[model samples]
Target: MSLSVMILEKEGGLAQTEFLEPSRKGYCLSCLDAVKTLQETGRFGEAQNELEDALRESENWREMAVACLLLGELFNKWGAASPSYTIAIMEKGAIYANRAVQLWQIARDEKLFEENPEDMDHLSSALYWKALNLASVAGLGGCERWTVLEALQAATEAAEQMSAMEDKKHSASEVKARRDFVEGIIVFCRAKALEGNHVSPTDFSDCYHQDTKDEVNFLRHQCLELFISAQEILSAGKQTMCDQNIKATTMIAVTYRLLGEREKAISWSEKEVQGRLQLHGEWNPRTQLAKRNLSMLKGITDEDEIEEDCCKLFSFESARSIKSEEITWSLDPFKLSSTWRMNCLLKIFLLTGVVKEFQIEEDKLIKFLQKVRKSYHDENPFHNWYHAWSVTHCAFMLMKETAIGKILGMKEKLAVLIACLTHDLSHPGVNSDFLIKSASPIALQFPFSNVLEQMHWDEARSLFEEGRETNFLSHVQEELRAEILEMVHQGILATDMQIHKQIVNSLSNRRDSLADFEEDDMTLLSDKAMTVYDATSPADRLELFKAVVHCADLSGQVMEAPVAYSFGRAVLEEFHQQAQREKMENLQESAFMKNLHE
Candidate 1:
């Protein structure tokens, strides 16, 4: 998707094109050449000023849309160059592209497309550029998840329209290439949204989540193919398709870097840098960005090295000497570092006989625990690894010391404890309300009800899947694996505070039935689900398990006053931060958060 300035001839210069007035043809050609030169030479401001002036002087909607599209392209390049202004600049580009789309839509509605069939191309191109701009904004973060979905929708619509065009004006190969290019960008944007960060692609410090790593890499490979195909198809039409070719090249470089093909990434990046230098000069922001990317690639190494180094930092000591009493809520998990928290969790797992009974390999279990610990972002004051450790520790205590512990089978108990450990996995610190209000990426992908809980359950399930190196349950009996995972899912979802009352009430309704069971009749709490118990139904048992985990999730409230106060304050501070972001974004702030801030 590019500026509608030229129709390529044999030499790739401007040809007789649609939307040009015969009387003003010479003037238009001369002006377009001058503007293209200004753009290529990196005189973006001058070119933009000129285009704005031209826009104001436009005699028709067609000219206006063209001017807006050009401005959007310029802003995209400008945003690429300036890191700090990327969001704002890309947003501005989206606005301009949207305006162009509107103008074209107006023109088409006025029967312009029917009268001049070639105008449909203009409309499709506007939509394509609009999609690209919005995708760029979404990929940069701060925008709502709806914006990303909208970009994808727009791109799809554009591609459909391009494919339906029967006009010979656009080459068949070029049309297909442009459509592929748009699809590649859509895939790339999806990958970035999945990453849940606005950080540069080169910054591998926080990469994909352990579970989503495969899916993200799959998308990367798919996009890389799309980009490579687009670049190859446009190779012969470089002069006419300069913008799209360079964009494909840029994406190819980025995709390779993300795919961990460092040398190929560097190779593609070097080509992009040289291409930009030749086309736009050394001072061009696009050229500068390419140069920076190339330099970063040369300096940095594989991200796996970071993972390896992290593994070296912590060792799992044998848990034979660790006491069960140390897993109680009286112990402050917040006081320990993430590594110590991991070690503590491992010891508890061992002490509880979960590892031994489940036939969990210690090394694989440690690896899984490390990944889970790392999944919790430390930047979140309330929902960090500390919170996960604390909640898990509380669950461990309940499973060992409480009446509910006595009622659960080993599979159910293990499920409840594991669920608690991972109940807040990959939490972004913001509450469900905030995620819903912002329409954040996770919010969009997940159902609105207990969105974060669903995400946690999904991630937890992924961690224990077959063939995963970190899967502690990989060698477990298929039947046992299914039972534990199902319980884990329910336990995790039950931790959603929104349904807290429902879960408690459900458990309350079963209390009479539960009390009637004798110690000998408590075989339902063990592995014999086939044995009919008089007092408890399977549903009642599940509800009890739900309530148990839910209680563990809220155990921070029952902690000693000082520890409880710290937790409360941490959550409040996190709420305040989310509220501030809402205010900055001009979104509706949470009422409680507003009250807290005031």
Candidate 2:
């Protein structure tokens, strides 16, 4: 036995040796046959119910354990069939597996294993499923209460049993493959934790990275070797080993991508796409996603192409016809594309007199806007450049149509507008919850709260750093510049949905408190409302500005029905993609996200 195996058995208080035989009569034969028939016919839900019913009805400990193990396997199949094998589903599998282990322990206490040595075979299978399910949900940071170390221990126990069995069902090579795959997952999870970029294995987002950090690259190289080894071993096993082999193949491709070996990554990805198509068919979501990945790899292009197009497409002249009448809250960002979006944004700034009042150089302003637009991930369905433009335009509409414009100084207005523009810089197409649960490097650095919001603020700070030419605030007076920067930070942080209700409640409370004034005073204040607003405390003004930007960030639902519907669909598509990744990576799906579909 390996050191890990020996240590696990000792720590778990399990026996060092056991004798077992494959059941010639296969325990609970009739019940299993019915479940298998349902599974084979693709009625996995029905199969799951049947096994669950069997578990409750069985009197004998051995029979109950067998039923529990079958139920665990059926849940696995059910989840995989849905193509959304979430952490919740994996937890259910782990529950059944744990029950099986407990049932077998009862059998061991009653000396049933001695009467029927085949009972040990069922115990070994239960151990294996328990380990695999725990590992799936454990992730790098530990999900619920399951940890990778626990999975490692369970796998070691299972390997010990398989090794000592007199009539093992799995061949020696297949057993080794299983062990290697589990070890590979541990290493892969570590690499993911270190690397910080948590894009899925099949996600080709930002595929042209110059290099990964040395530490992450080293771990990935180790993972690649183990996955390759497991794949080779599983290749010699029965067709039942095909799914495991495909998993290995996917990891190999992902590791190669992380290492910046595009040729190898593409080659392995092609094979994975083919395997997915064969196993799941063309219409299956996983298969469709695989095909999309393959297409992205084959279609990799020069990153400069977008920059060059932006330079050629945008100018002040492009915004000549963009008037207040044409551009309102009803503006559809989906129809505008990059060129018109950039132009419309410039026109809004011009209309608000932000450019002239701040004495911003036109060339510097264009360069700054171009860089800001490039910072957004065009690949993201919702939080991309178009979303940024839409948010900024909504803020502009509020300023023009409401009293918000008269209430703020020029600096505050400019800061809030800039905040809307860069709020989602370099989004990885996933949310803060994902980062925290996956133990991503970003989460480790930010820790506990406002994970994505803090990261976005950091990126925005980099773009607006004092001395850079792209920093449009460079020529502004030092005292005024500091004020704008502080407000920008507050504005960006305000966009975090975590604090949305607090902002709304504060704003509403302040509005309601205005009713306390005498009617005569209120009549006098109505004509000079701007005077009353400007005389309010600076802290109150800042809070009000934060509310404005926060509202603009979520302005989609308040737009015209058709435009709102389009934006809603785009939002759902982005959410579905994140939920899909959560499922594929064995992380917990967001409750609100699940509710959206329901």
Candidate 3:
């Protein structure tokens, strides 16, 4: 037997391993089948319940291992959805992964190998994934946790398993090589995970001796040593040093920086930044993070500047004139001081002329709009319906102020205004990041991606499909309705700052693509007129629509000092509440706290 097999047999495999007696396997299999179906449908919360039930009913370790591993993966998916509670969610996944290893061990101890020797392979795979989970994220809570060291031990043993696997009989040349590669990977993973933990903020409040300079320096040296070993092994076969190349290099930079080797740190970190940009492109979060780090190192900073909201209140007689066909709506006369809901709808009416142009049934659409307004939680500090109104107001202003020839078609314009109005629909006084990190049911429903925005899109679509009354687009052509629906999705997704660079670049690229139309179309219109009601490329038009909505979403940040600062304070209050929650649990606080403190 190979070393891994021998090790398993020696552990406790002498006993009979058929603990389940084969009769209960059918029920476990059916439960697993149900889990698979639920997972496929993105019903993660439901799938988790089924898997936990199977675990309770499992008669043996093999069945337990399967359940544990699947549960671990689902927990990870759930964590990804928890944008704010990611730390807690990921920790839960790690717990499940670690438990799976224990279950696999129990199977070996029972000598289940006599029935299916292939169980060893499952054990090996489980160990590797467990190590990966340990290394994937930080923010583990509790006072006496052994995080990095524990992860390193798991990874080291996993690598040993791979090394033993290579010597098994009939292990083809390719199989042996693959094992060799993965062994190297596990080693690098150990090194990278160590580096990750090394940088994790610790309680350095004099109460902890390990938080001192000497201890910190020693930890850095240990991390540097591991990265050097990883760099040599993983880079030996290729010039590119594909796996962990940037990670190792970045760690080296971080180590040097910690040691006060400024020049060396800058040199290595610049290389890491370049590699990240090349691999992930300019718009990726990793690329942005690296760029931000580089800028900090270079001592470059950008200060925020907020312009005034420019909303001025007008008397009823004067504001009423804006609705006349003869009078034009100008930003100067509009005020968002009071009557925000009325002004919000009035702005949209002014922009789209839906009632005048399309001749919509007034009571039908107005009542539905009221429902949409009421849906927003009035208690939200910043993301309430009022905030949504402000965003819509900004979008309307952008459409009107920009040259008509440069504006999007009527349908696109309407979609942007509508999107801004409902972008925060059903906002629970919490951000997407918060919901995602908490692994709330909503996050599970949208699992592993775009947690909040996807839910918002779902809400918006739901309202649209509520009935012809709320279907606001029922009067529009079928093709236009579909376009409007898609625009809503794109517009909402574009507001995600994680991909802000991509959205900006996409819009900037379109400026050039549509420039010819802008000039040619402008010549066909009057000097004072603006807007190109028709566009050549519908796909390109959506990009512009997204840009408009994104700008409006960020409008609060650009408002005049009083308004902008007020909104900033509102956001900060929400974050303070989140921080309070973290402190109560002794969990790692939001990174935004550091920014706020700074």
Name the candidate that leads on TM-score: 2
Model 3, 444-560: lDDT tens per residue? 455546677877777777555413235556576544676778888888887877888987776445444544556444332233322322356676567667877887888877776
Prediction 2 TM-score vs. true: 0.50
TM-score for each of the candidates: 0.49, 0.50, 0.45
RMSD from true fold, candidate 1: 13.5
Clashes of 1: 1
Scored by CA lDDT, what does every candidate get?
Answer: 0.67, 0.66, 0.56
What TM-score does candidate 3 reach?
0.45
**Candidate 3: where are CA atoms >4 Å away?**
1-340, 404-406, 466-468, 508-534, 585-587, 594-598
Candidate 2's error at 27, in angstroms? 7.0
Rank by TM-score, descending? Answer: 2, 1, 3
**Tens digit per residue, CA lDDT, model 2, 1-598:** 1111112122121121121221444654445654445423434345546656666777767667776776565444433332222356667777887788888877788776773545666776687677666555544334566654554455456545544555456677876776677667656655553343432222323233334445456657776888898888887565422667777888788677656576888899888888877765666545665675564454322453456665656666677677668877667888766677888877887888878888877666776687678778888878888778878988888778767777777887898888999888878888988987765545533544677787787777655543343667767764577688779889989999999999978855555456555544532224344544553578767976898889889988888887688778879988988888888899888866664565
Candidate 3 lDDT at 491 equals: 87
